[model samples]
Target: MVFLIQKSQNKDSKAIHLKLSEIIASHQGTSNRMVNIEDLTELELDQLRKFYVQLSKLAAKEDA
Candidate 1:
């Protein structure tokens, strides 16, 4: 299934979001932000998840 995450809120987040978008687009061959969960291998998904977690933590730090 395709997952469409919400847009991020600041410059750092926007950058991270753009990077992730690019990664998804590159992997999925589409311009849309939607990522196909089933298309990704386990390792790729784990790395993506880790990047997402890091981005969240970084955003939280910016808020503090």
Candidate 2:
């Protein structure tokens, strides 16, 4: 039962990832680098998270 549930969840996750990849590819300003973001290492994801946080701060400052 547990294995079946896990498999279903994995399938759903893959579908979601594919949909997001398609959206990223079709969007003009979106970064193609983000298409396979799930494959990034933990450290790389952390670095990207930090970069986005800083970007958010900068945007906030601009709005103020």
Candidate 3:
């Protein structure tokens, strides 16, 4: 039972990754670097998260 559950979860994760990759490829101005971003080390992902947070704040200030 444990093995079956793990298999299903893995399949779901792969499907989600593929869907996201397709979206990134189709969207204009979306960075190709974002494709396969799941492979990034945890620290690298954290840095990207922080960068986006700062960018969001800057955009908010511009809108004010």
lDDT of 3 at 3: 100
Worst 10 residues of 1 by lDDT: 1-10
Per-candidate clash tally? 0, 0, 0
Give all TM-scores, in the order shown.
0.47, 0.56, 0.57
- Residue 31 in candidate 1, Cα distance off native in Å: 7.2
lDDT of 1 by residue, 1-64 (tens): 1232332133335455545655643644655443444444546555766776787788689999
lDDT of 3 by residue, 1-64 (tens): 9998886676556545544544544547555666666666556655765665576687689999
Which residue pairs in model 3 clash with each other?
none
RMSD (Cα, Å) of model 2: 6.1
Which stretches of candidate 1 lie above 4 Å from their native place? 1-33
* Model 2 lDDT tens row, 1-64: 9998886676556545544544544536655666666666556655765665576687689999
lDDT for each of the candidates?
A: 0.53, 0.61, 0.61
For model 1, name the residue pairs that clash.
none
Better of 1 and 2 by lDDT: 2
Misplaced by over 4 Å in model 3 are 1-28
Candidate 3: residue 64 Cα off by (Å): 0.2
Judging by TM-score against the true structure, name the best candidate: 3
